[model samples]
Target: MKHARPLPAYMVTRYHGWKATTHAENKGWYRRLADEGQRPRAMIISCCDSRVHVTSIFGADQGEFFIHRNIANLVPPFQPDGSQHGTSAAVEYAVTALKVSHLVVLGHSSCGGVAGCYDMCSGNAPELEETGSFVGRWMDILRPGYDMLPEGDDEARTRALEKVSVTVSLNNLMTFPFVQKAVEEGTLSLHGLWNDIGEGTLEGYDPDVDAFVAI
Candidate 1:
């Protein structure tokens, strides 16, 4: 099947608008970034959801953050066994190359990935369990998180698992020897966050309280 050769007109129009406004206005900043290269302070792993606007929500400018988005913002255990791990590659570059001070895993409410995991764990989604299913395999990372939560209604379970996704990712990050060393040496800090898409609110995971506290 042939794919659309060119981008849609609306997308081109939006790009032009952005160029005239955000890009042109910050021409010098963009130029400087080009010349000096990027040295972002934080590496944010967030969902692929279009609703989660990383830069806008943080009021960040160009070159401010190193952001990576995947289905559920997950970081699998560091497996350097000649396997292609996109998330792990980003984490390695951010930590070893960029030497970023913060590594954040941002989960969000109404996460379809979390819901899928819920359905998957509950045996409601057979396709996910299939060997040919990529989403099912990916969401398996969140299985331990789901298993940790107290049983509840579907809505409650999904909501709780969304937060659990963050903590689980945080735990997974530590499995990397470099990440653990950085945290121990005080060069890096790990954070877990849950975004309420509609409410425009954020909650941070508190290890002490073992709950998500409004931030």
Candidate 2:
């Protein structure tokens, strides 16, 4: 704690600004949220990319959605071994503790993690190919999706692969026992979504069509 640096001036100023503006305006709402606790309807799993604003995308306010973000928005297969699992812990909490009605895996265009995976699989990214690279190891979860990538130009393939990452995460989420049981009981629903960041358009996975359709 002693080694950690103080907050940057800009960030501190922004926090004060928000506290005086948005937080002041919504004081009652914030107080109610703190008193009653959050009962978010959905748990949104999104990428850690700064450009991907989960709340802004849905026009949502505080306490509306429980969000978990990570590289590529990937969800690894359930292992349950005595090991630290950030994403799994979040999923468990959202399903068991929160009882969220919907669990959404959100992927987006121009995703660096997905691109890194593609390069790693293609033998092009030496840095990520290293066994010690955490990002490379984490991205191994998306290998199944890489297998399903359709033949196309680089741009098209990358975009299609982005959606594939979402699809893969949705499929992997079902591997968790709690998720499976909740889904089977008709209490929890899983969804996959891909966003075109530049265009501000979202596409949803359609099991019937086996593809991402515009939403």
Clashes of each: 0, 0
lDDT of 2 by residue, 1-34 (tens): 7899999999999999999999999999999999
Per-model TM-score on C-alpha atoms: 0.97, 0.98
Tens-digit per-residue lDDT, 1-215, candidate 1: 48658888999999999999989999999999999999999999999999999999999987889999999888898788997899999999999999999999999989999899999999899999999999999998999998898877889988999999999899999999999999999999999999999999999999999999999
In terms of lDDT, the poorest run of 10 residues in model 2 is: 152-161
RMSD of each: 1.3, 0.8
Largest TM-score belongs to which candidate?
A: 2
Candidate 2 off by > 4 Å: none
Q: List the lowest-lDDT window of 10 residues for candidate 1.
A: 1-10
